[model samples]
Target: MSGFASWIGGALGWTLGGPIGAAIGFAIGAAVDKATSKGLLLEPPKRGSQQRRKRVDPVYEKRRRRKTVREKQAQTKSGDFEVSLLVLSAIVMKVDGEVSESEKDFVRNYFTKMYGKQRANHAFKLFNGLLKKEDISTRQICQQIQMYMDHSSRLQLLHYLFGVTKADGHVDESEVDLIEKIAGYLYINDRDFQSIKAMFYNPVDSAYKILEIDKSATNNEIKKAYRKMAKKFHPDKLEHLGEEHMKGANEKFQKVQKAYEQLQKERGF
Candidate 1:
């Protein structure tokens, strides 16, 4: 149990149920077949009617394996973020008519940047299969995520989604509507939604939006907002999701910092 099987272990424990499981079943099966062929995962020989199933740590191998060097870290089923991303990416990419090459590249490049080429290839391959099924229910899939995923990871998911929506140069109105609805289903408040949304689509007051504050906010209010937003979007909040996910979390966190810095510079605070 290594490569793909290790990734599968997370789904087996968490997301391999309800709408999410139904949605990605084929893609996961296909990925398993490919991983098996690569000999990264060995199928144990069956004993009589009892099947031999190998059990691996639930996280994708990189994070779990790397964490072994550290002691007393919480480790358990972990692929919830990866699996959820695949389903949500398919939904976001396909929402605006056909999936654009730009959106595909955004996802592929992001995965490669975060997970390295080999694992990124595995993710994109599975994601392609998911894109084939265009009828995924966002509400149901989001419901599953909201119920099982931690709030910080959920925010990261929304951030990735907004990134996908903006990947094709311009964000479509339909995609915005759908993603907004998705935020609601994921239980994200409007302010948090706007904060993440502003990262991708910017206007004059975009920094204020990123801080979830209005233009008329007092200096003290702005300071509070900056501190609150900083805590909300901090990369450390997503540390449990592993180092790979920290890239996206850091992106959001930096936006919060930039927003704060802009306000600080403008008001001479």
Candidate 2:
């Protein structure tokens, strides 16, 4: 009875526990055999148990995906703003054919006021760098501007460009031509453009009046009147309004140019 009990105890320990229990039983059997020449003890081995499976939390996975999407959106918006600012700056500088120091100063000052000093400086540097490329087309610049900037922002940028052209206190005919070309590229209509023109360039100036030529006016009087109107409606002096109002100025200036041109052609001057 005692031997059966010992055998059953050894089997239970080895099966329910692990290799350590089996080794301990074998050691005891070895010691007993050396003392009394008995056979070694044996027990059945236990089957290995499987490990517990890990669970994936759905909430954690969703949060990780959301974070990734937000990061991508931020990168896209940053790239777009940088490209838009660069193209707009280039168009403004090119409007007058030769970018004057006064124009550059005005751009710098305006941007510094609108954005911070550091951002303004960076934007100007980028614009200058882009302008150095000999093969770049104006259309390509406009396309980039269109891609990244909104409608209202583009209009505001156009206003700033006109402001730059007028920074020297005089708007040359070449400057007006350039502004018109840029406006066309921006898809601004003739009527709307004229509206902006009127806001900036007054058509009621004496030169326009001389173009109508009062019957009593002498040649000297006409010439003097032309000079006075030319100074006033030159497209550089009109101010104190937003770009939407400036559209009227543009229209007024176009009429002034046309009338002046017509008078010169008739007078053979």
Candidate 3:
């Protein structure tokens, strides 16, 4: 835990406060509880809580306090995105009552592909602790994300969540409702939400939904919507996160292309 605390300084400069901090700290404490029960939390717990916060680093605290508001919300680190994904994934995995092996494997494969074995193992450990947690507030977590994360990253969060729910072969209504609620809290509008949500489902009209267009729209409208949607889901939008992270964004981008081609074939324009 000592080494982990030092690492947190750079990795989680902005996410180390608010409900997201509490949730991550609590999950770590839960996973840590098995090995030892007397360590301090990542952040302060409630007034009457059994756990306590470790002593603050005087120099670090002073420096943090001096940071300007703009500096605090600085670029969202890749670590921030991974931690946020862990917390949100924990919430969605438990939404349908049972946490199946497939969902676990989905998460495992996801991080393993993006971050390799060690990090994926660490993520699953944290995710397991979060599942055992009972008081997670989806709204509060999303609100915290809204305050710090960029729209492209937030949209990626939504994309992975929909995939998680469907990992077990079918997405339950309850799961959809929870993911949709998370989207709304993250300030993702209805059309944008539907467009991403459509990537997983395979209904007759899914292509239109993926492009965020109505079935009744004109041929030119479909072309315009395709151009607009294509840019919105472009891989370059998330290039700041590095090339590895672009894979997921690219998946969404490809879906937009497929949807556009389908529309073009149908409309013959």
Candidate 1 lDDT tens digits, 1-269: 25665565434445654787666666666665554465433433445857665786667766765555232223322466887888888987787678899899999998888778987877787798888886688889988777666677778889988888888888789888988998999889999998888888788899899999899999999999988988988898888877888888888999999888988999999
lDDT of residue 235 for candidate 1: 90
Per-candidate TM-scores read 0.79, 0.43, 0.83
**Models, CA RMSD each:** 8.5, 31.9, 6.8
Measure candidate 1: CA RMSD.
Answer: 8.5
TM-score of 3: 0.83
Cα error, residue 114 of model 1, in Å, equals 1.5
**Ranking, TM-score, top scorer first:** 3, 1, 2
Residue 16 of model 1, lDDT score: 52
Scored against the true structure, residue 204 in model 1 reaches a CA lDDT of 86
Q: 153 in model 2: Cα distance from truth in Å?
A: 2.4
Q: Whole-model lDDT, candidate 1? A: 0.78
In candidate 3, list every pair of residues with a backbone clash. none
Compared with the true structure, what per-residue lDDT tens digits does model 2 show for residues 1-269? 23423432432311222332232333334332332233333433435647654686889978977676445333333223333444455555665466677777876776566455865665565456555543445564554344333443444445556666678787878777766776777666554455445445646544434344564666676677566545544444434222323453454456556665665676677
- The runs of at least 3 residues in candidate 3 whose Cα sits more than 4 Å from the true structure, single-residue gaps closed, are 1-10, 30-74
Of the pair 2 and 3, which is ahead by lDDT?
Answer: 3
Query: lDDT of model 1 at residue 128?
Result: 85
